[model samples]
Target chain A: MKVAILGMGSVGKGVASVLSSKDLGVMVTGVADSRSGLIDPDGINIGALLATKRSTGLCGSAGITAMDVVRGAPYDILIEVTPTDAVSGEPALTHIRTALTMGRHVVTSNKGPIVHALHALRSLAASKGTSIRYEATVAGAIPIMHTLADGLAGNEVLALYGVLNGTCNYILTRMAAEGLTYEQALLEAREMGYAEADPTYDVKGIDAAIKLVILANTIWGTSSCLKDVEVRGIDLVTLDALQLAEDQGCTIRLIAEADPSNRILRVSPRILRSRHPLVTEGTLNAITLVTDLAGEITLMGKGAGSVETASAIIGDLLAIRSRYGRCD
Target chain B: MKLEMRDAPGQLVAALKPISDLGGNIIAVIHQRDPGSRSEVLGVQIVLDLPQDRLSDLTDLIRSQGVNILRVNEERLLCTRAVIMIGHLIHTDLGGTVDAIDRTGFAEVTGLTIRMPAIDQRSSARFTIRSVNREHMEDAIAILRTVAREKGLLMIEPMGVSQ
Candidate 1:
């Protein structure tokens, strides 16, 4: 399949490298960074593109922009990996819309577009007779969307509960394991590259809330936005509270839950037992899908990283190829 | 098809010769003989890949051998639906209710979960039924409704519309 990648970040670079290394029957026709893009109808040289990015810090030269790749590039699937703008859901949203309007399938890892405009974009893709897959959006490399949409096809999902955000989970784990203060744990997390310099979204629960909204929309076909969630992050979770919970054979975890029957969605730091399925340390994520036929099925895996996220992107690409044959 | 034949030498071979003579490729043959039963009949179930035109001839040949045909299933269940039933499930014979759906040939109960708080109080169960298509699903629901009414139970349909 001829594919175009928009966003030459870690995830994008990882996807390009995987496509180059593996014979997944896919060709990278175009690639873009924030400022520039590279497009060739006959499939761009992935090795040369990576070398160019490494040497000059950009994927394309002058006169080539992301808009050009979206509109003019000859490809069947558009892979949108742009940085998320939670408030606007911009550039990524528009790029996806344009690609679907032009009758092309879309695979994305960006959460903003899906969280904000999932219903609208899904309707557009359906009307256009295409598909949009974002397996890496919620929990990186988890394949939760595929599990719900395809793996459990005949089963009805009654509820979903998960530990989706890695940054907060890392901070909480550190504070509990080391008996360190919240500030010290956050500092250690930043030093370890787990927490961003500006960790407002992760610490204040906005990130997990966004993920919950995406899960709700995908699983239940609900048009739930970020504002609909009752958000409560790990900002106030203290070492004292952790110790207290530990004393009670429990640990604190930022849990995101969605109950479609009651239309309830929330993310909060809850006290979980030591043996609970959702309790995991470090940058790991776990989700339990309570379904009618499958009972409670729990899946756990790495939630983020360049190579891991690329694994999910490649999975989406293969799923598309299996559904629709490789582009001629 | 499933069948029963008299337990004797060559009885098992006799049950399958008709299918082969009618140009059917045998996929599987399950033969179990119960010597303890008074009738001494052996249970035999066979799966065959036979042409559509020869099905009648094959059945005629099998019946001519005095073999009793138990079931003739031609369609496979492809769609699924889940419903909740409440009100004294165990007391009303939940197993019989499940058996009624499973015997429909087009629908079968695939999953079941029961919740009971007390011995004599009302109980609830969530059961999933898979069928061949939408029409079969409706028929299954109608059967469940009839069973529920006869047993003084209530059926709670799923909230989301069928996709």
Candidate 2:
């Protein structure tokens, strides 16, 4: 299958590297970074492009653009691994819509478009007789979307709880294990490259809220958005509070939850028993879905990373290929 | 127990004094008043819990006060959930915060433990809220959520397996 990948960022590079290294029956025909774009009808040399990007950070000419690849490329799938806008769902939204309208499959690791324009995008894909698969939009490498869509297809979902933000989890874990203050733990996380320079999105619970909205909409078509979640951050979590929780054999974690029947969509720091499945340590994500037939299902894996997120995009691409047959 | 009494002053009070006298915990006292009506009798329903052996004695004592017993209903609190609240407890009127739930009568904060780290730093408290059942517990939690928002407190609620 041929794919045109956008955003040449960590995730894009990871996907390119994997496709080049393995015989996955996948080819990269077009690639783009924020500044440049590449297109070749005979499939691009992903290994050479990755090396060039490592050295010069431009995949193609500045004259060409991501939209050029999205609209003009001769590819079977548009792989969108762009950085999330969280609000506008912007350029990614346009790219996704244009591809779906042209009857091409879309596999994205972008959360913004999925959270904001999920239903509209799905309608476009259905109308065009193509699939828009976003397995990489939620928990990284966890296969959560696939599990909900296929594995637990017949079960009724009662509720969901997840530790969705790795930065917050890392900071909270450091604070609990070492008794570090919030500031100290956050500083450590930043130094370790787990947190961004502006950690507000992850620390303030917005990132998790976005993921929760995607999960809720995908599972139950709840039509929820970011604002619908009653969000509370880990900024106020104190050492004393952690100690207090420790006194009772419990710990604190930032949990994104959705209990639609009870009308609850909240992302907040919650107290959980230490032995609970959702109480995963340091930069890992865990989700527990309460189902009627299965009772409760818990899945845990790396929440964010270059290669980890690439696994999800690759999985979606493979799923699309298997269902619709290979793209020449 | 439902009681019928004269609309005369102090008759309602006279009817309720026995539950306290017999060491019963009054849960709810539901009554309706219509001053525009000139009815001679007032009906009141009281929900309370007490030792099983003390039930007959409490009923006898209420009747002795000239309050006619109409109907009796019994219910027990069946759920308890503990939540941790972190904020300036004293500044927010902790008593009032607790009273908000207790005032509902169907739920109460049965236990509380506070840890004050310093004079100005935030304090943390764990409140064990008990309710008649899961439904009432949810309502009590909603009330506490509102109270937490009003008082600038971060309430960390328990996360059950099924939410």
Candidate 3:
């Protein structure tokens, strides 16, 4: 399968590196970073593009643009792994829309478009006889979308609870394990590169809420807006709170939950037992989905990282390839 | 519950009928007829499982059946949820917060443990709220949420069904 990947950040590089190493009958015909774009009718040299990206910080010719690659590249799938703009399903949304309108399959790790234009995008993909798969938009490496859509195909999901934010989880883990104050732990997270400079999106619970919106929309087919989520950040959580939770063999975690039956969509700091399945440590993410046939199943893994996110995106690609079958 | 009904043959049937009418399950009924012990009344001990809300209705129906109820032990407020509130607890009128649930009749804040780092700093408290059933518990938490919002407090409810 020929694929075009946008966003040559860590995720893009990881995908390129993996495809270069694995002879999985996949070819990268096009790639684009923020500043440059590359296209080749045959397969692009993954090693050369990565080396140029590493040395010069530009993935390809600056004369080319992202839409140029999206519209002009000859590929079976468009991998839209751009940066997320939760407020506006950004340039990625337009890119995905254009690709689907062109009757091309899409695989993306972008949450902005997924959160804003999922219903519309899915309908457009269906109308064009193509589909968009976004496994990396939620928990980074959990393969949650495939698990819900394929592995547990017939089971009805009753409810979902997740620790979807890695930065907050890291802060909380450090706070509880080392008795660091919220501020101190947040600083530690920033130093360790787990948290961004602003950290508002992660610590303020907006990031997790966005991922929850994506998961909820996919599983229940409910076009839930981000505003529908009742979000609470961990910014105000104090040492005393964690201490009190630990007093009773429990800890605090920023939890995102969706219960369609209860009409609940929430992301907040919740008291969880220390041994609970959702009480994941460090930058790990965990999701517990309650289903009728399978009961409750918890999936946990790296929520964010180069290879971790690439794993989710590649899974989506392979799923589309398998469903449609190999052409070569 | 233990009951004293007249030793009439059909009196026992009258009392037992109301138990099932209220959608109660009769787990066991120790109605032993001591051949020589009963002077004029039959002392029968009955155990049953029923919704706590219908305890009053069951008591009323059994009394109208001419059975004197000596003792009734129905556990009310059997369901409890623990929530943590972190904010200016005292400044926000913590008494009002607890009173909000306690006044609901069905739900009450039964336990509390506070950790005040300093007088000027914010305080954190874990409150155990008890209610009769799941619906009542939900209502109680909703009230706390409203109160927490008004007080500018962060209310952290327990997650998972195990709590």
Candidate 1 lDDT by residue in tens digits, B1-163: 8998887788777779998888777878987666677777778999776766788888888888888888887645657776666678898888999999999987899988776757976665667789866777878887897897799775544322221
Candidate 1 lDDT, A205-300, residue by residue in tens: 899899888998888888888889977677765565566456557777888888877566878776667788889989899998989998999999
Of the candidates shown, which would achieve the greatest TM-score relative to the real structure? 3
Can you tell me the DockQ of model 1?
0.01
Per-candidate local distance difference test: 0.84, 0.90, 0.91
Worst 10 residues of 1 chain B by lDDT: B154-163
Q: Provide interface RMSD per model, one decimal.
A: 16.1, 1.0, 0.5
Say which prediction, candidate 1 or candidate 3, comes out ahead on TM-score.
Answer: 3
**Model 1 residue B78 distance off true place after TM-score fit, in angstroms:** 46
List, residue by residue over A264-286, the lDDT tens digit for candidate 3: 89999999989999999999999
Q: How many residue pairs clash in each candidate?
A: 0, 0, 0
TM-score against truth, every candidate: 0.67, 0.83, 0.87
* Cα lDDT, model 2, residue B46: 89
Off by over 4 Å in 2: B1-78
Question: What's chain A's TM-score in each predicted model?
Answer: 0.98, 0.99, 0.99
Residues A44-143, model 2: lDDT tens digits? 9987898898899799888989999998889999999889898799889999999999999999999999998999999999999899999888889999
